[model samples]
Target: MAGPTILSSPSPPSEEAGTILLETERLIIRRYFLSDAPAMAETGNDTLVTANLRAGFPSPYRLSDAEAFLSTACKPDGTAYPQHNGIFVKPLTADNPSPEPRFIGAVGIIPKGDVYFRTWELGYWLGSASWGKGYATEAIGPFVRWCFDTWPGLNRIEGEAYGSNEASQKVMKKCGFIEEGTRRGAAEKLGVLKDVVNFGLLRSDLEGVKELVRDS
Candidate 1:
């Protein structure tokens, strides 16, 4: 059960290549880089990881898949797509010190338009090896706050999990997302129909929430 000493950052760090969006005790959530394709492919190529994620994530994820995703997340000149990020394992210890940030997962929001312009959808996925460490729970809170702070017009953020994904549901609960309802048989994954459970957090829900660190 190794961990980092600093559990929260009032101000997140920044770098030229990737802007550090948020930091927690053991994770660094930042914009993805094209070079991350290899690591992304390696870590995301698990059936379990893809099973819990959206249909877009391919099983046996290859370098090509990772490349396409990176291409979509950022432009050739390195400008980020604005909301996607890679979740890296922060190396805060000297023994395991490595200059490179270890890519472990990702988190992002899909902007809604038209009548739902003020709303957004939240999604995240971690490598199977990184599961059960509370990293998802730790990262989501501040990320949500950052979203509210970054977009003043943003009123609500929505998260949906397959009914079978209890772990994801728990993470949403821990992050102050209120369970809205279940959309029965709304999604089909791997040829099986699954209920989608909806959860939401409004800007008003952030009244007492704190500890969001954004780069200047």
Candidate 2:
């Protein structure tokens, strides 16, 4: 595989303000915490999880690597900061008012400033063990809803999945994103060029989706 891109921008400053944690019937989407480093390392270090991602994410991810990621993700005013929500399964709730959340995966909104700051790209990854459980679909829908409600200036949310990643494409479709087109050799994964299928969901599209979900 090709070497990872080195980030040119300075890292964001740390902040104590916590991000909003959203709960679905089966998952809890929340901000990263210091205590989650070990779990993050365990999940992210898996080769299956990192293979689809950009080259920078190291294999055999260490605790220190997880700490650095948490710092970057929690930065106060950074564009690439805490916008990534860690996905977790909802534990038994009968004994508690709320379910105990366990880390499983992550989803994020990556803003493209050149696109008028009104467009954000969506990215997600789940643990190999967590695959095929519809968690991606369940988590992504609410995250998009929360994004639109939280960021009024957002006009569009876009995503691109490798052609071979049918499951990811399905998740985007289920979350109301429409296929825009395809880009051949858009990315290189594991030393080979990969085709990518683009998907997008506009603000108006989200409105229709919201209505349908409400009626159901």
Candidate 3:
């Protein structure tokens, strides 16, 4: 079997206000750089990649679209939402570390409004080339855990996927999200309506699981 990979990038200035946010065995999650636009364009251009995603990403995603995304999703210093990070492939060899991590996917959360301020809606996607590699499951675990730890008042993290998107549901399940409910005909893509399946992980649920592991 292949060995694990590590990702490294040039450290920005302390005053620059940007740095890697998290790391897993085969991935590094960080803020988006303007230089990453080309890769995002390529990945988002694939229909299979954006097929199940929400309305934001344009079909045949162009470089302009990628630039726009970086503009909105990342601050001028590239550290807009620390939790909504770009997924990059780590280096396969320690001696030959990549100067810039390979952009492959992303994981992010959007805060709910009004009465649901304590809840966050989760979303993620990967290039088709990176699919079936267990990267999604690996990336989400740390990301979700970090969200709960960073915000003391946060109560729940929720994820919704189209009913046919079993792969996404599986990733959420692996990250400890429970199937809370399904909204029938709640989503429409390409003029077709599909059921929307919802999953959630509570702060208490995560704490309980950790407690169980410690006791066992």
Q: Estimate each model's TM-score.
A: 0.84, 0.82, 0.83
Please report, as a residue range, the 10-residue window in candidate 3 with the lowest summed lDDT: 6-15
RMSD of every prediction: 8.8, 6.7, 9.3
Residue 23 in candidate 1, Cα distance off native in Å: 1.6
Best by lDDT: 1
* Model 3 alpha-carbon drift over 4 Å, by segment: 1-18, 76-83, 94-99, 208-216
Q: Show where candidate 2 strays beyond 4 Å.
A: 1-18, 78-82, 93-99, 211-216
lDDT of 2: 0.74
lDDT of 3 by residue, 95-201 (tens): 22777577888887777766787788898999998899878888887888866776666789999899999999988877888899999999899899999999999
Candidate 2 residue-wise lDDT, 1-216, digit = tens: 543222222433233534445677777777777677888888888988887777777776788988888876765553433366688887775322445667788888777665346777898889898888777888888887766665666778899888888888988888889999999999898889999999999888986688433221
* Candidate 1 per-residue lDDT over residues 103-215, each given as its tens digit: 88889887676678678899999888888877788778878887777656678999999999999998887787889999999999999999999999998877744433221
Q: List lDDT for all candidates, in order.
A: 0.77, 0.74, 0.76
Candidate order by lDDT, decreasing, is 1, 3, 2
Error of 1 at 108 (Å): 0.5
Worst 10 residues of 2 by lDDT: 4-13
